[model samples]
Target: MGAFTRPFFIGFRRINTYSLHSMRQFVLFIVLITGLVTGKSAYAQWEFYGAGGVRYATTEEIDTNGKPLVKEHGFLPGLEFKANYRRGDWLVTLGGEIYGGNLVYDGQTQSGTTFSTDTRTRQFRMTTEVGRYVSDAVLLLAGTEWDYWKRDILGRGTTLGMEEEYNSWRFLAGAQTRVLQASWSDIYLTGLLVVSSPEHLEVNFDNQVFDQANLSTKAAIGARFALEVRPKAYSNVSVESDFEWMRIGRSGDAILSKGGSPVGTVAQPEHVRKAIGIKIKYRF
Candidate 1:
């Protein structure tokens, strides 16, 4: 065992976070070795596991139908690596993970105007935590980390253009406990509370009426959770799944938009997302 053992974890959505992707690689590595060693390619004493994420966002358009004008989706790709070290009641977990993907949206309109845009999105994150043993099978963990991100928006036709940078101070505190220890595998559940600050240093479009830029920098608090199964002691394979909800800085009127005349009464409602995703990890 190297560090934090329970596969891996993830947190918050709206803005992309890097935890979930790292773990999937670890989970898959376990399965490949198990299949070769056991003669069966199916799940064995060692196994692999993961999940995928799908996100949706509502637009700023208002309607006589009382419906927001548009909606869109964001899909991200991520992976994880794990090395856990456990001594009876205490242990340390260290790992590195990366999330790479594109941010895309399809504008919904009350009228005939439909819009779409795509931007480059990427995040690199890593963490380390120390765990204090509570019981022979339980551990409480706490730690901190660093997260770096970059998002670029390129307008196609009538939409907006945005280029933003997000670098955050990441603080994590959490716990994991043994749920069941069976002959085949060990099951555990983990939860983490994360506090971070994301800054947007550049704005190219007006947040309100300008067709170029809109949206603000944000610092927020969020949470992450995961459930994992370890097939055997020192086994290379495992099964894990996770969920994360994140609130990035909100969308506010930019410098350019603030002074512009209200364009035909434009309105923006709150934007929220519930993302569920899956992935697989493989270790060499």
Candidate 2:
């Protein structure tokens, strides 16, 4: 497998430590804000919901030369939960989801060697947002989201596999509108623009635990869209379909290390992910 199997691992122990701390702080801040907002009015309206769905996700990594190096795609079952509080024209919402499955992996090396395997994948996402109803049918929102993903490629004969982990934070601004309303049903549409920062990736080769590489932080932009339908008959039930797309720019080169000693330089290629899902939710 040549370089593809040559134990390319990225070490991010210190960085991950700092990131975890920051993430905790952010979560705490969100909780504090939520408490403050909701405490103002004992009569604030509250809604809670849980959802289950299946998602199809595809991820691709490109080479420095802009050629595709690896592709992984799969369907995963997932669950989501959310809580919303509304007072007057203001809204506060917190939500999260977890999903994972085995993905079919296809990869090709620069020297034309090819391989196929299965990759175990897991992902989690959390979001907090505040919004205001601008009109009877329109709402504007701003939010922050944290995303985490991990993949473990199974080794094949004479070939080594590796594990990759990624973390990122995103800021989003969006608007939602009730597109259609009737006595029996309502349909809503939402669109969001997202900006991501401090993208981090860590890699570990199964065979060479001592070798590592670091990908420099890069910013990315993405978008999300959702369409939701609520049936009057059920009153508190809704179904939603959503799509998300993101691209992480190619990272700058960093020193590769073996046993804490610098060996050479390596850079992470551009990465892209796309996902679509349908979910049914029940609210109380």
Candidate 3:
């Protein structure tokens, strides 16, 4: 009986050793596959980036009868900054931008009066996002953005001076992918969509201000496409070109009396905006 019991205990120890060894091998295999999926381990976790650019933005204001009341077009210089965090194949970014310019527009009143107005514009934008690489060269991101558009209409001599401001929040999604990659250079493409929430509007003229109290703001949509070129792998400098377009639904009262009184209701003015720009960015 002692000999049989000793052999049974020895077999149980062998089986336990084999099971532990197999478990270790399985865990190591999983680690190897995870490393491959992430591409590389994170080294630098944070980066700061800045950009400067020139933008040509076009704006149009339409009257109730669907006729254009004003078409403002001009070029502006802009600046932007970003803070970025990277881990494995994922990145998070926070950014802000601002631009201002002057546009000239020819206006025709209902009485066939032709006049010109100088429209000065200022815009501020803020954004936050998280992005992940779906492939070695492709990335997708979803984000949120806030935008403030301010327009000041100055008189061209005897005309009236007015101001219009629109503020909105947007839901954004986009994709970025490499278009060309070589030893000397890399080219990338990026596209974006922005859908705005209910906007807020403020208008001021002749010492009177009209805003959310008496006016309604509508939704807006925007799209943008950009191209980026990196000249060297070791350098953090890049050249970029962007084109964007936006359209906003009707806003404000079409018929505000000369006395600033609310008159019979008319269709609100519609807004359309388009822009193209080139920029340079440095990352550290």
Alpha-carbon TM-score of each model against the true structure:
0.59, 0.85, 0.77
Predicted candidate 2 versus true structure: per-residue lDDT over 1-284, tens digit per residue: 11254444211222346446645754665465456555645544877677899899998888768778888898988887777888889999988777889988887643457878877887878899999999989999999999887777777765666666778899999999999999989999999999999678776656575464446557999999999999999988999999999988888877767788887666667888899999999875
Regions of candidate 3 where Cα sits further than 4 Å from its true position: 1-43, 209-214, 252-268
**How close to the true structure is residue 20 of candidate 1, measured as C-alpha lDDT?**
39
Cα misplacement distance, residue 276 of candidate 1 (Å) = 3.3
- Model 3 C-alpha lDDT per residue in residues 1-284, reported as the tens digit of each score: 00001101000101223234434543554454344335433535777777999999888777667777767788989887777778889989877777888877666543446666666777777788989999989999889987777667665444445555667799989999999999999999999998988677654543343211224568878898999999986488999999998888886554544355664443336778899999999875
User: What's model 2's overall lDDT?
Assistant: 0.77
Please list the C-alpha lDDT of all candidates, in the order they appear: 0.51, 0.77, 0.68
Evaluated against the true structure, the overall lDDT of model 1 is 0.51
Best by lDDT: 2
Clashes of each: 47, 1, 0
Query: Candidate 1 lDDT, tens digit per residue, 71-93?
Result: 44466777655445566577776
Give the top-scoring candidate (TM-score). Answer: 2
- Model 1, residue 226: C-alpha shift (Å): 0.5
Cα RMSD (Å) per model?
12.3, 4.3, 25.2
Q: Once superposed on the true structure, which residue ranges of model 2 sit more than 4 Å away at CA? A: 1-3, 7-44
lDDT of 1 at 75: 68
User: Which run of 10 residues does model 3 get worst, by summed lDDT?
Assistant: 1-10
